[model samples]
Target: MTGMTAEVMTPKEVETAKEAAIAPKFVTKGVDVYYAEKQALTNVSLDIETNQVTSLIGPSGCGKSTYLRCLNRMNDTIDICRVMGDILLDGADIYSREMDVVHLRARVGMVFQKPNPFPKSIYENVCYGPKIHGIAKNKAELDDIVHTSLQKAGLWNEVKDRMHEPGTGLSGGQQQRLCIARAVAVQPDVILMDEPCSALDPIATAKIEELIDELRVNYTIVIVTHSMQQAARVSQRTGFFHLGELVEVGETEQIFTNPKDERTQGYITGRFG
Candidate 1:
């Protein structure tokens, strides 16, 4: 496994692998990202299945977050960042000249590592994206979306009485859940979470993990988490990245119990992280 290369598969091997994999929602081929002269990702090709939770696990600065940002063109926000690859969302190229970055973001929403909610009220924070995207036509529709998003995020019951309160006033855990509610309000095709539980306590983290499992039924989810146990608990598929490259990817159980790459094995078994 030490000599294993990056997805260098024969036609037969590719077909064999496909036999076990679900059809992809996002197809990334030779995806690469560069910040100034430094390369962040190198020829990463992976398929994210629809209606499933796929987790990306790696050490710090190993390009896990960089690669996750590529899903919805989030990297475009950085002036020095340059992306080269074909990232197709449902067979349509996301980086095509005709692609609308705003629409793309609406279709694929993101939740950051920290709970960076707006300085507005909890209800306003949840309603902000839907209003901007014109997802809600009237007050009733807006209210429905807000209610459903918070309900789905497991925060409605806790924060319902305080709808007019500022989002920053909530506890760290509640703030994070509010952020999740905000992302869900847009009704995106895919949800990208970057260490969403990193700032949370065990109870808060467990609740978020439960919400993730429930959300996968309606939306495809891709998460970047540092904790191996969290990945095992929440994700169906797991991808291990090392040194700006994807070392291996497979079913979560297989990746944990029988890794094909030495790097993946080392990272998982506390040999190195």
Candidate 2:
């Protein structure tokens, strides 16, 4: 399949191509966010293409995670966090008062920095999302979703015989993959990951990276990572954030080899974080 192009074209040509090309699954425009009175993001605009992995990289407190949370409205859980501007999913603004937080989260799922599986069994953990979202009509359907999700996550072979075991009992890497399987159970259109491999070793990290590549065929993925190598390995596109602003965004190869902005160059070149 042909990927989306950043080539400049006339308005009419762009419109025609846009119609022919797969539209962005997510669009954020002029998005500003604040925690209490302190601004955390400033006029951040971007498009997350469908069926591709997009990585957000930068120094700590650069608003990468904050911007990610905004996609699924996870910031709504924080009382002091306020957001302005628009975030659209398939052309509808998700921040609108009419949007349902429960439904929105199901459509846009998340995996945290540390794997936090439920106390339940592995099978239950994978089935929980489908159960909560009412995606499964019955026990048979729930089992099918659980099996499919685990297979997609590349964990089915490892844990298929131990479905009744507690998810917390698995190794760190296994638990992380279990979390990914749980996210997939709901059949989300987009999956948001916040430093998903920060706790794992290199081998586990490699496994997760492979899973990320496979997952992009079915879900739009947005990852916030501190590891430059990890970002380069997994993402199709990369966004560099600095001081609460999105400094640059381009193909992963371009961002690494030839950054357009000084700040991005500094970050990637070991001059600064």
Candidate 3:
């Protein structure tokens, strides 16, 4: 046809563009947090889209985890922590009195920095949430949930024969994946992970990263990590936090290669963090 230019798009690129056009899964506006008058997060606004991985990256004590806690109202557990702002999940206010904290948390499940599997069998650990939430109507139903969750977390094959063994008996990586299975068993719409691989060995870390990539296909995932390389590798969108503030947020490649803010550029480039 004539002289023309065309842009090549990969599968991930196409998915990212599709999600960008949809309404975000969660929207936070002008959120602020204080720990007994000492501010931990400044006015922060961000959006999380569905079926995608969004990463929060920054140095130590930069309020990344604090901001993540806000998603599921985890901050409310602390007596000294106060959060003020509008955070909406699926167009409803998560902080409203009309919302039940228990149900809200069920909808937005969390996996912490360290693997904190229950002191129970692996099967029990995965079924704990569904049992408490009454998500299963019978033993057979609960069994199915447990099986599917473990399979989704990529741990079923290794632990199927040892389901009755303590979750702590598994390797560190398996324990983390077990915790992830527990989270998935709840049938949550969003999964929040705070440094899910911080304590794992390289092989374990790789497995967790692979799981994260797969999990994003069904659940909206948000991860906080100190590893910039991990963030670049896993996230479609990345947010950079600095000194209790969100310095910048954009596509992962753009944030890594061409940050608009000086603070973001500095952090990503190792100039200062």
lDDT agreement of model 2 with the native: 0.93
Candidate 3 on 1-273: residue-level lDDT in tens? 001115776888768656653778899999999999899999999999877899999989999999999999999999999999999997799999999999888889999879999999999999999999999999999999999999999999999999999999999999999999999998898999999999999899999999999988778899999999999999999999988999999999999889999988888888992
What's the C-alpha lDDT at position 48 in model 3?
Answer: 92
Residues 182-265 of candidate 1: C-alpha lDDT, one tens digit per residue: 988988888999999999999999999999999897788999999999999999999999988999999999999999999999
Best of the candidates, TM-score? 2
Lowest-sum lDDT 10-residue window in model 3 = 1-10
Q: Report lDDT (Cα) of residue 185, candidate 2.
A: 85
Cα-based TM-score, every candidate: 0.91, 0.92, 0.92
Clashing pairs in 2: none
- Displacement of the residue 59 alpha carbon in candidate 2, Å: 0.1
For each candidate in turn, give its C-alpha RMSD to the true structure in angstroms.
Answer: 8.7, 5.7, 7.7
Q: What is the lDDT of residue 106 in candidate 3?
A: 83
- Local distance difference test, each candidate: 0.91, 0.93, 0.91
